[model samples]
Target chain A: GDKVKQSPSALSLQEGTNSALRCNFSIAATTVQWFLQNPRGSLINLFYLVPGTKENGRLKSAFDSKESYSTLHIRDAQLEDSGTYFCAAEEGQGGRALIFGTGTTVSVSP
Target chain B: NAGVIQTPRHKVTGKGQEATLWCEPISGHSAVFWYRQTIVQGLEFLTYFRNQAPIDDSGMPKERFSAQMPNQSHSTLKIQSTQPQDSAVYLCASSLQGEDEQYFGPGTRLTVL
Candidate 1:
């Protein structure tokens, strides 16, 4: 039983298309952070949310703490977007610690 | 800033040996975190420190694993009696505060034989 669960263990999309990744938390999450692990295995920060929505360029993210879930949407996906997406949640008064999801491996093909 | 710096990008050790990994957080950052990544486990949290003091290490194995932040700038993770199952990439991250967005290092790949 994972504290944080990610949907669609794998995803494949065509370049210029769109796709969404999701995370569901069993813990009382106060904040959520999303990361993209590139092919070279570097984890890049994507978004950090506190029960709201944030948009950065072609990427949009939403976090609903009450519902214990978060979503990351990629618009006009590009080849550089091909990587593993991970979501981490900070639990109730968890202090700086985070519980991580298994991650979604996304492949964008041109 | 240099993001977070991890030393010994890769390490190989025999079973029952010891391994020590180091991390240097961004200047002035107050928090540091350690995580391990593998195909099966994905990214797993191991420990965290705030202002050079350990805040949480609930994710760490009860035996043979330890972490320490001697100062605000750096931290170290040590494992004794390393096993092959310990082979994975270890990542270090830093944030200005406990709840802020974290910046990660490239990670150190460990192979235990």
Candidate 2:
């Protein structure tokens, strides 16, 4: 079984709309990180959370360790947001490699 | 500050040849990680080093894949006897000692023919 799984393998949104992406962890994830892999193949870090929630501009992310799940909410989607969103979970603590989800492909159309 | 740096950016190797990928972690970071990404596999962890010491390599293929971090600033992933199946985008990442937030490099695309 996959240690990390993402829902809605692909999503299409209109500009100014809102959408949510999710990650479910089978491992005992201690922290979660969200990244957007742009069309150019560079991964831009979006959020790094250890429980609770974090908001950055139009992006908000929440990580619930107890439930072993995380959510990334995008408000007012823009064309630049069209890319692959990946959620990675780190098990235990320091020096551990992250287990990445399959990722959700997002396409924001004008 | 510059994020993680992966060298070559792209590489082409014939089957049975060898290929080496390089990664320069962010300054002051103590942990370095390596991953391989493909359309079929998504992203898979290969190995990781903390302060130049290998912590885990459970995800690495036992046969021809190897990784080394000789110093705090740089690490390398070497693939001996490369095969077409070994082609993928190799990514390097780094994070602080106790923090789980990792910064990634642009990645090196390895193509085996």
Candidate 3:
């Protein structure tokens, strides 16, 4: 089984609507990070978490290590937000290596 | 600036040929990571290096894949006897440690024919 799993392999949302992406971890993740890869193949780090929630602009993310899961929420989806979303999990204690999930391709229709 | 740099935004190689990808990490970053993204598997971790030394290469293929960081400024990933299935986007990222955000470069997209 994959250590990290992402829901909704692809998403289509209308601009100004809300959408959410989720990641479930089977491994005992010590940390989690979410990233967005633009169409140009440039990946931007969105959030780094350690069992908590954080929000930036219209994006919100949460990580729960005890249950082994993470979620990324997008509010007021915009065309500029359309991209592939990926979440990576790190399980080994004090280790920085990450196991990436199969990304979710998101497209915001205007 | 404040980002990782990768050269040769794209490359094409023939079957059984060799290819090399380069990455320049941000100054002062101690840890560097390499990942491969494909349409089928999405993002896959390849290896990681810290302080110019390999820390984990378990994700790399045992046959034709090798990576090295001879200096703090940059690193290289080499593939010998490339196959068509090896085509994918190779991304390089750098971070200070487990705490800082990992900065990624505009990946090098490889096409093997």
By DockQ, the best candidate is: 2
lDDT of 3: 0.90
TM-score winner: 2
Q: Extract clashing residue pairs from model 2.
A: none
State each model's CA lDDT, in order: 0.92, 0.94, 0.90
- Choose the strongest candidate by lDDT: 2
- Winner of 2 and 3 under DockQ: 2
True contacts kept of each: 0.76, 0.76, 0.74
Residues B5-112, model 1: lDDT tens digits: 998899999999999999999998899999999988878889999988888898899999999988777899999999999999999999888777788999999999
| Model 2 steric clash total | 0
Candidate 2, residues B15-110, lDDT tens digits: the string is 999999999999999999999999999999999898898889999999999999998989999999999999999999998883568999999999
TM, every model: 0.96, 0.98, 0.95
The DockQ score of candidate 3 comes to 0.67
Candidate 2 segments exceeding 4 Å error: none
Off by over 4 Å in 1: none
Per-residue lDDT tens digits for candidate 1, residues A1-110, read: 99999988999999999989999999999989999988888989999998999999999999999888999999999998899999999887646677799999999998
Global Cα RMSD, each model: 1.1, 0.9, 1.4
Clashing pairs in 1: none
